[model samples]
Target: MQVIRNGFLSLLALGALTLEGHAQAVVAALECDFPAASTDDWNMAASTLQYYIDTARGWRVDEDSFSFDGTANIVVDGKDHVASLSITVSRQSGRANKTLRSEGRSLTVSGECRKMEASGRKF
Candidate 1:
């Protein structure tokens, strides 16, 4: 009788732990930052970022664009515009698909156009 009771309690404990884990997985957020100079540059960066996000099998983007109120900081330096944009990307396993939140700055040079590098991790 004691053996049966112990087994039942162990099963109950295991079930509770499983439930807790599931709950935790259901409600969690991941955050990161991608730095850029201005809106046009950010637009280019966002395109590449979108490409990766779209290609990933299990990942989904939560928001589509960056709100100036939430994720953008702009500064003008002589002939250059410096911008920092914050973006959030999220994915759900089963029902809800995915989303991407993007924000950044654009650079426009008056004279000759030059090649520039955009840097950041997609995931």
Candidate 2:
């Protein structure tokens, strides 16, 4: 059986990701301890609702059955400090691995992600 599959149930697989029971691609924020760059962060744009990071732009989130199904496989462009970031969150352990290829820097980050409050930060 494939663990969590879509909807709020999928959030159950990602311990760091949690919403108010309404999980249909909601705007959320990600804060991780990136040793390569502490300022590096991530968030799901409220407007595009697309996942992106602070390293640089040009990120295309691929659509697939695994998407929003416990594991998020994001494909990135061949440029920028954060070349690629793929997160496989499990209900037991939630962590983000970051690598800045330019400097050969790498680190593992862990933090909580919650539903972002609309309005002030809303796009």
Candidate 3:
């Protein structure tokens, strides 16, 4: 009887621990998109975004690609520093030649992200 009772109590404890693990909140990656006015316009915008992510402390820029549309993944650590920034840009041209004047390029960036550490406690 004693052995059976002990085994049952142990099982219950294990179940409680599993439930607690599932209850913990996890930080998820945030995604964002920046649309360019023209295919040529993306070069400047993407460059600016990369610069911001690289310069920020503790922040990381994971990957970058450009075509016609642009997308980026930015990661910030618990210290509000950037952990990673992955970007994709796409563009398509058939017949017309595209020319981008250097002087016309303008970029502006502002903002900050805070990071939260994951608790070891389950759920």
Candidate 4:
């Protein structure tokens, strides 16, 4: 009876540990899209988004987007440009939604994906 109880408790502890590990998995990439924009516009928007993500601290360029371990803020300085943009990313899970406003235009993109593979030229 003692051995059986110990084994049961051990299994429960292992199961809880597994769940905790999965809950802390890092978000690998962000899937972004501009559905209403044209191909050229989408390309430009994706490029600008990538630029912002690249400039953020603790983030590394991963083909199209940026990858980071923890939470970070993406801030774009307007300078000679019209408007600036700011995006906050939390790497707790596979979920993200960010918006960029510039030159009287707003671009929104979302979805945290596993891989950084691009489907096509225009995002």
Candidate 5:
């Protein structure tokens, strides 16, 4: 009887440890910065830009022209009265490339994942 009781206690302890490990898996915000635009037409659009990738939830940003989830490759094709920007995130590898055009001038930027943090609760 004592041996059976000890075995049950061991199983319960193992379950608790597993739960604790799973709780630590979480997603944090992601940010990327691009080069300065050569022309003033894209100044306003490039100033207030932010991007985030949540491993569980998906990708999010403040711009309306950009829409992406965490799973597939990201693509951004946006155009306004004064400027336009196109971006693509590679699926086969972890890399991103972007191009911004305004007033007959263009700027390009490339990005890669530096580090990912797990701060928030898991979904």
Candidate 6:
């Protein structure tokens, strides 16, 4: 009976992992700098933003993001006439590019990403 119980528990754990996308995910933060875009610039003063990425779906930038398929890469597009911010990051290489526009001025920043502990290099 004990052996049977152990087998059942193992099966349950395996099922849970399977349902959760093989337990794959990536957690990281993006840090960037922006020069003065005039005083009327957007208030995105945060130097770093945390990301919670779903390898099969998409990632959230500090809990907000434009939805897109992020299996191979991360792509986001947030725009309007007054302001726009777009991001593209390769999941395999961890290279990132971001563009910010406000009040008719725009800036693009590119850099490598640092994955958090246990986050691994690939999503």
lDDT-superior candidate, 2 or 5:
5
* Cα lDDT tens digits for candidate 4, 51-86: 123323454544443444432222334233333333
Residue 58 displacement in candidate 2 (angstroms): 5.9
Q: Rank all candidate structures by their TM-score, best first, as comma-separated numbers.
A: 6, 5, 4, 2, 1, 3
TM-score of each: 0.19, 0.25, 0.17, 0.28, 0.33, 0.39
Question: What's the lDDT for residue 52 in model 1?
Answer: 23
For model 5, residues 28-83, the per-residue Cα lDDT tens digits are 33334433333433332232123334333334433222225222121224432343
The lowest-lDDT stretch of 10 consecutive residues in candidate 3 is 1-10
Model 2 lDDT at residue 65: 9
Error of 2 at 110 (Å): 6.9
Q: How accurate is candidate 6 locally (lDDT)?
A: 0.38
By how many angstroms RMSD does model 5 differ from the true structure?
A: 18.8
What tens digits encode model 1's per-residue C-alpha lDDT throughout 1-123? 011101111211111124545531122222222222234333222111111222122233444421111222232342333243322233221111112233333332111111111332222
In terms of TM-score, the best-performing candidate is: 6
Which stretches of model 5 miss by more than 4 angstroms?
A: 1-29, 33-50, 53-81, 114-123
Candidate with the greatest lDDT versus the true structure: 6
What ordering of candidates by lDDT runs from best to worst? 6, 5, 4, 2, 1, 3
CA deviation > 4 Å runs, candidate 4: 1-83, 113-123
Tell me how far the alpha carbon of residue 61 in candidate 5 is from the true structure, in angstroms, after superposition.
Answer: 14
Candidate 3 lDDT (Cα, whole model)? Answer: 0.23
Q: How would you encode candidate 3's per-residue C-alpha lDDT over 4-57 as one tens digit per residue?
A: 101111211111123655652322221122333333333223211111121122
Give candidate 2's whole-model lDDT. Answer: 0.27
lDDT of 4: 0.34
Give the range of the ten consecutive residues with the poorest summed lDDT in model 5.
1-10
- In candidate 3 the C-alpha lDDT for residue 2 amounts to 11
